[model samples]
Target: MPTQNQSLLDALNACVAACEHCATACLQEDDVKMMVGCIRLDRDCADICALTARFVARDSAHAQHLLKECAEICKACGDECEKHGAHMQHCQECAVACRRCEEACRAGLAA
Candidate 1:
């Protein structure tokens, strides 16, 4: 089996961690209900990143497809997170992480 590149793995892992953290933070907000959309997207993005990372890490036949979806999801998650970046540091951090991971995922696909 082909080995996964460390850079891509690191980025994907970061995305997963950031997404998870963002979701938890959203849940803790004073108007938690208002953050429902953010939390939902965060959870969804986390699952996508986690699954995509696993697929890429294994260098499976579907890695390319997974990576593509990962990039798209990361972009979406990043955009959504950015909306609340000014009010929430966690959102800002997650946006940064997601953007990085998105770039890495695209690079991994090209590689």
Candidate 2:
């Protein structure tokens, strides 16, 4: 992969990890029902990030399109996570990761 893709790839991977972690942690929370939305978005965000990373890794023709979709999902996931961040460390971390990934995706599109 080109050096230009490295940062985005790293961000994507980190977001995937963070989302997965967040989802798992949310499931174990005292009120799992309250975390349903966060859990759902975390899973969705992780899947999209993973897919986008694969597309970018291979320099796929559809990578740019995926990047745009990835950014949108990341933003949504980050926003959802942020809602619970005040009391959830996992959500806070996930939100930060999602934000970084969203910014990276936007930068990739700009490039």
Candidate 3:
């Protein structure tokens, strides 16, 4: 793949790691009950990101459709993470990664 596509793939991978880490860390927090929504979104976001990476890497016909969906999930996940960012380092990092991935996905779709 080209460097441009490679960068998007890298962003997807980073976001996946961030989401997984955030979900795990949230589970360890004292108020696990309050983190339920965040946990669900984190896992969903990670899965979508991984799928998006695969679609893009293979230049699949569904890539554009998946990118759009991925961007939406990333936005939602970032919003959720930002809500807990003040109290959790993992959330803060995940929020940043989600935003980056969101932007990258949109750019890829536009291109």
Candidate 4:
């Protein structure tokens, strides 16, 4: 991994972890039905982040494209997570992580 890409990599990893945790926690919530969208977005965000991290780490030719897609997914996930942030600690944490990852992805694209 390039030295400059380290921050992006870190953000991707953190987002993946946060999304997975949020998804699991959402599944356990009493109102699981209402959390379906959040859980789905969390899972999607985690998958994209993980894949993007791999591409970025290897300096793949498609990294830029993945970064764009990752940013979009992260933004969506963050928005969804933010909806439940006031009542759910997991969602709050996930929202923060997703926002950071989204910023990192945008930065990576700019670079």
Question: Model 3 misses residue 15 by how many Å?
Answer: 0.4
Worst 10 residues of 2 by lDDT: 1-10
How do the residues 1-111 of candidate 2 rate in per-residue lDDT, one tens digit apiece?
677799999999999999999999999999999999999999999999999999999999999999999999999999999999999999999999999999999999999
Tens-place lDDT digits, model 1, residues 8-96: 88888888899999999999999998888888888888898889878877768998998898899899999999999999999999999
Candidate 3 ranges beyond 4 A from true positions:
none
- Per-residue C-alpha lDDT of model 3 across residues 13-107, encoded as one tens digit per residue: 99999999999999999999999999999999999999999999999999999999999999999999999999899999999999999999999
Query: Rank order by TM-score, top first?
Result: 3, 2, 4, 1
User: CA lDDT, every prediction?
Assistant: 0.88, 0.98, 0.97, 0.98
TM-score of each prediction:
0.93, 0.98, 0.99, 0.98
In candidate 4, where is summed lDDT lowest over 10 consecutive residues?
1-10
Question: Who is ahead in TM-score, 1 or 3?
Answer: 3
lDDT of 4 by residue, 35-101 (tens): 9999999999999999999999999999999999999999999999999999999999999999999
Model 1 has a clash total of 0
Clash statistics: count for each candidate = 0, 0, 0, 0
